[model samples]
Target: MKPLALTFLSASIIALTACGGGDDNAENLTTEQVLSLARNTNSANQNYPDSATNELLMKTPEAVTYYLGDGVLRWSTETQIPLYFVSIDGANPPQTLIDGVAQLESRLGDIFTDFKLLTWDVQQYRDTNASDENMGNDTFDKAFFMAQNNLSEGGMILSIDSGYYDKQYSNNAQNMCANSSIAPFSGALQILWDKTGYTYSKENLIWTNMGNNHGCKWNTQTVMHELAHGMGMYQHFEPQFGSWSDGAFDVLATLYHNAPGTKWADLQVSTL
Candidate 1:
């Protein structure tokens, strides 16, 4: 991956330094203040796992619980999971994507009393010269850009863009709708939507595939699947309802049945 742009890093340092005293006095800061500093600093450094920096910035138990734990990082449902909708290179997010998120928010609200999914902001990035040869890099570029601009602090970024063809799945690009990291790294997560994939629609908030004859199509379930990854559901398990031949079982269903606790990583049980 390319290094985060130097100018962005410089600007981030300047912006964060303005927030409070430097790292030497971080212990005196409140949990929220320290979280803000750590998040911005991690974003500027491209979200790589940095135990040393995390230890330095996160002094409070609340901050440590929110950003670090025994296993993969998971979002605490006690606070709202901010979702930032991003359109890259002028490719507007599809209506389906918007509706799907609303549906997710509703379902999650019903599932957890304190957990809320908030539509924090809608943003646009003008990467007019982005190339398909490195689509994953491009996705991270948009993520880092949003992070540096302070638009996605301690949030999940969902970016919609056209012309993304994952080379690893080149033969089935049309069937691949979207992708996301399995969990938050450095207190943030990212999701990339491929505008060229299967057409999606919703009826009664249940997403259905309306395009493509092969592979799984993009739908609300797909969003949930990818978002499950963002929420730290990493492993794929056997389908509960139907055979994989029909693309019936999804990560979301598995998560729904297995997630009985507040911690998402707890879903990694022997049942799956």
Candidate 2:
């Protein structure tokens, strides 16, 4: 766990030469006291409960209909979840990269049986906020970034960072493949693609010189993995799924039922 990044608004008070104009109660408290009171009031209003979808999952039985993001927890026949690709590096993603994501969209039905491929609407954009090149690595920084750049509700962001001297990913000469975070307040998930050049092979899902390999093995699979994290499959290991299995075995394990061939279902209920 790292330190949370927070932007504290500076509290100030102007001394008035005339004493009778201000409210008597405000005059009694110091500037620090006033700020403390305001922050306490705000904190008291926050609800710590998990999102509704998460609550339902906790109380309901295992089902094939579960989803991975806080906003897009369950796919609806009537509506599609909006998925946005944000270029935090300020470089527009090439067509090959875009095509890879499209392929994933095509395969969602096969991957998630009850989920409809049509339930997700997709788009790409150059981020209006700071690029990944300048963003901080902590949870609060990531949360603030999403708050500034995210476009809509039930919307997920796939962010691309320029991977240069990133404190979280690029330390010790390492390149982060990708990372993700969910907003505690909103349950929206943001997937961060870091470092490694954006160069990709002509074929879809193959990134040359990117994310720990030239091919970026199972590019779609990796996206699904990170998306699962955003959706609340927070655990990092499972004996049935493999050492570093993304807990896909728990909820959507049926999709890959034969692989690793362990009869495990819904790690969410069992573990959490």
Candidate 2 per-residue C-alpha lDDT over 37-108 given as tens digits, one digit per residue, 9 for 90 to 100 = 222221221233335545544553332122221121112212334454443344554454454445434544
Number of the predicted model whose lDDT against the real structure is largest: 1
Tens-digit lDDT track of model 1 for 1-272? 32111111112211211111001211233334323322332223344356545563344222221222222223444445555443323344466556556655554453322222323222222232433321322333434554455543334545432223333434554433344431211112222111121111000011111222223245555554444444433322223111111111223332343322223334332111
RMSD of each: 17.2, 21.3
Candidate 2 positional error at 45, Å: 21
Name the Cα RMSD for model 2: 21.3
Residue pairs clashing in model 1 are none
How many pairs of residues collide in each model? 0, 3
The 10-residue segment with the lowest total lDDT in model 1: 198-207
> What residue runs in model 1 are displaced by over 4 Å at the alpha carbon?
1-73, 88-93, 110-134, 137-144, 162-164, 182-217, 240-272
* Worst 10-residue lDDT window, candidate 2: 13-22
Candidate 1, 213: how far from true, in Å? 18
Q: Which residue segments of model 2 deviate by more than 4 Å?
A: 1-78, 88-107, 110-154, 162-176, 182-218, 239-250, 253-272
